[model samples]
Target chain A: MNCLLCNCQLSMRLCITELFLPIDHQRETVCDACRARFSAYHLSKQCCPGCGHPLNGELLCSECQAWKNNYGQFLHHRPLFHYNEAMAEYMSLYKFQGLYQLRMVFQHVVQMAIKQEEYDLLVPIPVSPTTLRTRGFNQVEGFLEGMQFHQLLTTIDDHKARQSARTRQERLVSQQPFQLNNNVRVTGQHILLVDDVYTTGRTLYHAADLLWQAGCQRVKTLSLAR
Target chain B: MQKTDFYGRRVLLNAEEAQQIRIPNLEIMPAVKKNGDRIYCYRCGQTSSCDTSHLPNNQYYCPVCFNLGRSSSLACYGHLAEPNHFTLPTSILTWSGQLSPLQKRVSQAIDQGMTNHQRQLLWAVTGAGKTEMIFAGIAHALARRERIAIASPRVDVCLELFPRLQAAFANTPIALLHGRTPEPYQYRQLTICTTHQLLRFYHAFDNLIVDEVDSFPYAANQALLFATNNAVKKTGGILFMTATPGRTLEQQIHRHQLHVHYLPLRYHGHLLPQIKINLAPRWRKNMERGLLPLTLIRSIKATLSAQHQCLLFIPHIDDLPLVEQVLYRQLTNSRFTTVYAADPQRIEKVQAMRDGDYDFLITTSILERGVTFPEIDVYVLGADDSVFSSSALVQIAGRAGRAVTRPTGRVIFWVSALSRSVNDARRQISLMNRKGRCLQRELSSL
Candidate 1:
């Protein structure tokens, strides 16, 4: 099999290892050289307690500290990689370019990270209707391709600008854009909010607030990039 | 009173809004197909089915052309109005350069073809001043208040032609469109763009001229052919100019689908440089053993010592590093560089060679055409390889002896075994030279 990202011939042994082992996060769609280019976040690195951005051994980064000060309810977040140049290019191709084949490049690693977590339900942050109409596929749902996830939270406003388009301060102070689905029950359940990138923690916080209002006991967050 | 830019200029939307402004200009052509909820676009012609969306009713979006601002079923092509104003200069052809008698003859035929609105093929040999011959025809079209577009298969050709066209038509506003170029799309009397950019235009030009029509990704490609056909208006004309016409174009000529015109002589009145073959058996094995073939090494030394630049062409990009290392050891006293298609320093290395900073440049076929270096000899390491087509071999030989001062240069092909492509290239060059000699004799008698 050839890697989908680079079209390089993939090793049969590596494919077999990926098929048999869960911890072996090697992907058939990604070549070894391209995989090495991604700056994956390590648990051993000094990171912020809230957003998971790499830090200098501080308990919390200043941005996370500001978030904690503004809102007492901080969602516990885990990120798989730092927002390096390679990750930025990956997002540009997968999200902006609508090259859905690149979703396979980060599938295995993100799935493995999600498997290590403990949560009753996984809910991906919903995209605006305009994004779905234009981009054809939800990028966060693309990362969680085969894995099971619930669409409990629906975007409330179709005309609201995307969180990525807003400044960090604007995003932090923006009104809620998520509304819990009345038919689905999130009450008294541990919910994990997933996204492709955690830019300012505002999008996840908005989703978490709606779940809290729906009587969810706990809320955590997971993203492919920070 | 609000104004919005449509093509390149701003116009008031009026009270009827943008919809009324877009309606009268657009008439849906056979370029759109509907199957159930999906629609296929004939413009970018790359996909069978576009993704359907649930906005403004069920709309279909061509995902392939999303980068070019979403060519979809919801969008209508801009209807270009006929030019009612003729802002012709006193002398439209501002070029101070000279064209040979043969070039002038073909140039007049092309101008006549544009006026008659017919398809004509200008089969000129390389170094025949093809671009210079088109200036008169373009000037004629501009004076008639006709929109003109010059499309090529390669971006390098478009980039090279843009500035030359701009300089020739100083009074006319020209737009250059290519994927990598930073120039924005605009409505001009003259437009020069790559063939891929032709998909964005609909019934846009009154006269379309396609250069390098047989080059890669354009020859025998249906999508590009569709774009070329659809880009012109119903009554518009097309002029195809190429050095090496591919098999499809030749078949078309045989079937009388296109009218043929020929200019067999170069601008300097010299014949194309013929290719000479030398057998280099197992040259790759010799390189691995740290020894170079005596015949190939001698060829490189002769050209370098003669104070002429040498362009050593390799068959594949994978062989570049090994060949560069072998040549570095063999030609110890020469300064040379290796370049390939994906090399980041490709442009800089080529400029360095043009500036006479390098004695020799070992390159792949990427520099076979659209590049000219004065008094340079050409060599192909493996002319028998499958990677080297007959047309490519002709173009490679055409690279040599391009300058007016040095009208002749050596073209050597070092092959392990004689291939049909190699023999065909030699025969094509000899055939063109014969035709050129016949033309010269006819001119002398007249």
Candidate 2:
């Protein structure tokens, strides 16, 4: 494998002796040349702590600024891919087609985005039963394999309040907040929520609110594509 | 976004897994599976996929974000693709062509009445050639350029009848839609599908004919019936085919509210099958562990010595292997094979038997209906077991006498108790044959 930028051979480079050394594959791949370049890339420019849009910080993206009056504040969110044809087909096959091999493809893309990024936990957005039934496997969970699991960052809303709301956003806003199972401790913990594609950030914001309310110090999201 | 952690033993997705897509207005969810790799939701029917709602009343619902949804019904991906055979009837005539006078008359009434009415039920008796009766209706609708759909609850039976239906009509396009097949038949003139698959059509089919309406999976779910109706074209027709009508339909039949036609006897004049019962000690238990309760074993051996063919029907799929093994040991000299729905080689094994390669065939209720054997006597080792409903038992009994020359055969229900299914089966057949005799006598007088 050759680096897209440098054309340097991108094989896992290590001496036979380094086999016993503790290492992170992501760190190895985020080479000095690549890491330094990625750090400066305009795509990684600072944005609102509440949203990952181009930030003048004068106002929040409509999703974040008015979210509290509606859903709530998101500490921050990030996406690796723009919602496009490649990611759509990739996620479709990953979720619907039951293409297990594509997990490696997803992992590679996710790994590159998360390079040197720190989070106490990486939560996967949950898939519903209806969706899971249609596709034998959950593609979000499919993409999350071999990665750390965390608390449910998002959830559906109130049992009765949304007795009238039909839109998915209404469903999300009205949904009861999703939390981790009984055993996990997320207080003061920073999290990296992972998903296949980045959609309207309502699901992510609600997930952040739940974690924040549960005392998580920070909540960040990372997806295969924006 | 929130960080969520689940203490539940997380999920694993493997190759060969059935995946249901989250998309609506698309038949894209992975097929629900009885056995294969599947990731189930916390709610629903405790299978792959689930209703997204949780309840405080201790009822089953989604455990995660509460989204109200239905139970986890298994997904059927649709039918497998087979080459379409639409050749018009030529030298190849149908089984209906050989129907007796009474059979023809009753079938004609059913054909005319059912298609004439927009919504009606038809209660045909156990030995009635229901499929044969429907050919005229199917032909009538086709002649008017109307689309027709004939579906059954059992996939195995629809598969058995598909080729037969294709053979009956010439140059008529017929598509057999089921879970295993992928393509939707938007263009085909005729469709035969399993009832579970009707949910996918959503008003795509016209002239919906549901065979075995009072059967499982569909029987328990009212939504299935709704879905069946939903599959039909507006102002279209529904013709339900059943050996035994339910209480409501029976009442309708008595009131002449339902358009019912009866074929009391086999197409050819054959006596109703003889039912010989033996109350042996846990016959199935003895048969397992290679012991066939001496008495039953001896009877089987005696039949084998006479060079007669036999079909052994066990009650459950779980008992199939043991039943097969025991029968194999006892009838070592006979050509025999076992087939079941679970066995991928099922079609192959049945085909082998059809080819006259096997003298003895062991099977389960999967072959209880629609399949025909030349002259094989059937032994329902656990016939009186609760699994064999009255209708199922009657259908199984009908299998013995479908072919004219093979009309006379032995049917043994080696059971511990006289189950209602067994008794009802006996009564229904006896009553039908008695009706047949009365009709014959009336005809002679006329």
Candidate 3:
């Protein structure tokens, strides 16, 4: 098999794990060099209870504290990776360049992260109609390939620009863009809002606000990047 | 958005606009296509079985061409018969530089091709002033109020050509587009862009000149060839400029599908530096043991003693550190640097070599064609290695004897054995020299 990114042939050999395990679980999309470029967030690192930004040893970061102060509700958002320059480039190629094959690079890790959580349902942030037409795949939903997710929210605003295209101030001041579908019912369930990145947190907050209004008992969030 | 924004532009539409926009003569733009479960972009077609684009119910956007803006199945192309703007310059050829008599003749031929909208190949050798030869033809097309674009496969080539073309046609508004450029693209009389950027244009240019058509990934890519054909109007002209024309192009010329114009001689009227082969068996093993071939070391010492820069082209990038280690011990007093394609300091290192900061640059074939350095000798270690193609070998030889001041430089192919590619490259260089001699004789007679 060839590496998905570089097209170099992947040298696969039967290992000790193959003898013990009947089924093969190795699904490496990127070469070791490419995989090394991305610095994955260690699960052992101490993170802010609200947004999951790594804090060396502190219980809560200033940003999450400020978030708690602004909105009475605090979201327990667990992010898988830190938003570094390498991650920025990765996102630029995967999200902006629309290289859909890149989604698989983070597939197994994201699936494992999702499996660790015990949310009643997964609610991926919906892309606007314009984004749906232009980008084809919703980038937020792209990482959750084999995972079960509920597309219970749809974009209600057509004029709103993408969160990625807006500035931090613009994203913060942006109005609500999503509306819950008629069939979505989480009256007493723990709803998990998933997104690709947590930039200003306003996009997820907007989704959470509508879900709370729709009578969800509690709301937590998960993202690939912070 | 206003209707004017979409005019003569490739834009995606929502489900409502896809059904409602009924512009006459509109077509499902060839840029976007719907394959079974995935949408194949007529642009950058990246085929992977797992297409995740969740377009609104069966619609698809080609993720491959997303860098040039999105091309999706739900989009429709609305093209104007002619560009909305055209301003003919009073003096199109603003540069005061002179072309050689042979170049003038070739320039006239290209101008005539532009007049007749013919597909012609300007098979010029490296350092033949290929860019300058196109000025007269571009001026002709500009005076005719036709849209023109000079596309190359390499962004470095496009970047290098943009300023030169800009200076040549001082009055013309030129737009340059590439993958990493932050400048927003706008319609211009003369557009200079990488071949990949041509996907965004639809029948946009009347005179399309493809420079370095033999360079990769454009030489081997059918999609880019299609983009080139689809970019120009049906009646538009195409002039291909290249130092090394590939087999397909040769076949096309023989079949009379492509008209050929030869400018085999460099503007300096010098022959290409012929390649000299020296065998060094078990060179890799020798290098691993810190043993250097005395002949190769002698060549490097001679080139350095002559106060000329040299490029040592290794077959693989992995061989760089080992080669550097061996060379550093032998030539400790000399200033030499190693670079490869992904070297972080590749640009700076090449610049340093050009700026006369380094005596020699040990590199891979990444610096094969786009770069130019004066009075430089070239040595290719492992020339018999399959990593070096025939065209690449020719280009490597073309690197020598490029500058007008020192138009004769040494090019040695140090190899274990003479490969077919090496022979073909040697033959091609000598063949061009013979053609140059004939052309020179013909010019003198005329």
Candidate 4:
């Protein structure tokens, strides 16, 4: 097998325990060198409790503080990886370039990260109909392949600009683009929203706001990158 | 996009762009085809299982040629029939450079091949002025109003060849295309692009010349070969130029399927520099311990004393820092630097080397070809490594003895153990040199 990112041949050596046990293990899609490029956030690091943003012994980041003032509560966001150059490149290829096979590169890691969270419904942020028609897949849902997830929200705006193309201020003040699916039961239920990246937490906030209006008891968020 | 953009080209377009082009001559085709459980890309001609490349709603995109554009089922290809629209220019060949008698013969053969629309391969040695020789054929094709494109596997080679081709055909408009070219595609009589760009073309060129046919990505890639075959018209001519032909080309030559021409001597009429092998066992271990082999260091010193720059080729980029540390410690007064593909200042460092800023450079296989430095001796630290293919070794040796002032430079390979590629490289060089010697003797008798 070759690394999905770099296309280098991957050499697999079975350990003594594995040789005896003979259990089928999921093969790695990326080589160790390419895998090392992505840096996972350590839970013990000093970070904002709300958004997982690195902080100096602060309870919440300034962005989260602003969110708390607007909404009754800030989102409990857990990002798996830092938004480094490698992650940016990965996102560009996986999302913009539409190399669908690249979704497999982070599938296992994202699945494992989501397994640690407790939620009644695992909801993924939806793409605009235009994006769904053009890009052919919701990038957030692509990471959650082969897992049970609820498509509880749908984008109502047809001309919603991509978050990547908008400036930070434009993204912050942009109107909510998402709406709850008709006849979805989320009342008094814990909801977990999934997204590909947490840029300014605006996208997830929009989705969470809809779920909150739908009478969800609580809302949490997870992303592949922050 | 204009009608001219789709002329002789197959560009993937969305529904909006497809609706804009209303020409009756436009041939629209699906970007990808589905058969059972497989998806076949029409552009690259590769079949993939639907599971790996599928989109939502039973749509599939080709991941192989994604760099060109996303060729999913949602997109369609726009192709306009090639009208061979070219204005005959008063003067096509602006290059006044003269080819030698042997090179002139090969140039005439190429011109004839192009005229007859035949497939041919020109096996010319390094520094044989292959570009100058092809000017006559390209000019002939242009005069005949035949569309032409010259492609290479490496972008660096295409970038280096574009300006030279523009200068040669000064009266003709030329388009340059690559994965990174920002300008939109235009209809031009002549085009120079990388081989990957050929996937965007549909029987575009009547005469296609592929340089460095044995180079990376082109030699080992089947999709590129399919694209090359698809880019040319059914009756069009193709000329493959390379110093070393790989196994596939060699088999074609043996089967008499490919017409072959050989220019065994350099333009300066000198035999290639012979490779001298030096066994340096445990060199990697010693390098980690911060020590280079005594013989390698002495050779570098000798080449420096002779006022020639040195090119130290290592097997991998990971070994560079180790070799660099030892070089700095041993030759503290000598000016040197390291370079690799990922180095941000790669182009600048190569320019600096050309400006005589450094006495030597430690580099990976990225600099194995398409670079010429005068008065330089080459030393391959690990010639037996699997990374150094036979052709790569030959190209690395070709880097030496390029300039007329110093037609004979040293090429040494420090190998821990002898390998087949090493033997093949040595044998290939000697075979060409012998052929060159025979040509010289025949010319002298004449």
Task: List fnat per candidate, in order.
Answer: 0.04, 0.08, 0.40, 0.72
Q: Spell out the clash pairs found in candidate 1.
A: none
| Model with the higher DockQ, candidate 2 or 4 | 4
For model 4, how does the per-residue alpha-carbon lDDT over B303-363 read when each residue is reduced to its tens digit?
9988889999999988988898888888889999999999999999999999999999999
Q: Which of the two, 1 or 3, has more TM-score? A: 3
Model 4 residue pairs with clashes: none
**Candidate 2 TM-score over all chains jointly:** 0.54
lDDT of 3: 0.81
Candidate 4 CAPRI classification by DockQ? medium
Could you tell which candidate, 2 or 3, scores higher by TM-score? Answer: 3
DockQ of each: 0.25, 0.05, 0.38, 0.70
Off by over 4 Å in 2: A1-226, B1-100, B115-129, B138-148, B154-194, B200-207, B214-221, B229-237, B244-257, B284-290, B324-335, B351-357, B443-446
**Model 3 over residues A111-178: C-alpha lDDT tens digits?**
78888887898989888877665566788787887778999889986845777788888888888888
Tens digit of lDDT per residue, candidate 1, span B1-446? 11111332222221223345544443333334566666666566655443322223444555455455554444444433444344666766667888777778888988898898888898899877789988998998889888889999988788889889888988787888888867545567788989888877666678999998978878867778888887887888999998877767777889998887878778777888899999889987876787666877888898878888989998888888888888787788899999998999999999999999999998998988878898999988988998788888989999998888998999999998999889878887887789889998998899
Model 4 regions more than 4 Å off: A22-24, A43-46, A56-59, A157-159, B15-21, B35-37, B279-309, B324-338, B343-360
Candidate 1's C-alpha runs over 4 A off are: A1-27, A30-37, A100-109, A145-147, B1-39, B47-66, B72-91, B95-97, B180-185, B305-307, B341-357, B384-387, B404-406, B416-424
Query: What is the full ranking by DockQ, best candidate first?
Result: 4, 3, 1, 2
Model 1 TM-score on chain A? 0.88
The prediction achieving the highest TM-score against the true structure is: 4
Q: State the lDDT of candidate 2 residue by residue for B1-446, as single tens digits.
A: 00010111011222222243232222223322232333343222233322222111222222211112122223222221212223333333333477656767866776676567456665555455677767777777666556577888878778988998988874666778776767633446677778765654544444778888766656545556666766665666777777655544666667866565555555565557857777765776676557766666776776677766778788888887787777677667778877887889988888888887888777888887768777777778877787787777777776675667667877777887777778777877777678778866777787
lDDT tens per residue, model 4, A65-111: 99999997999899999999999999999999899889999999999
Pick the lDDT winner: 4
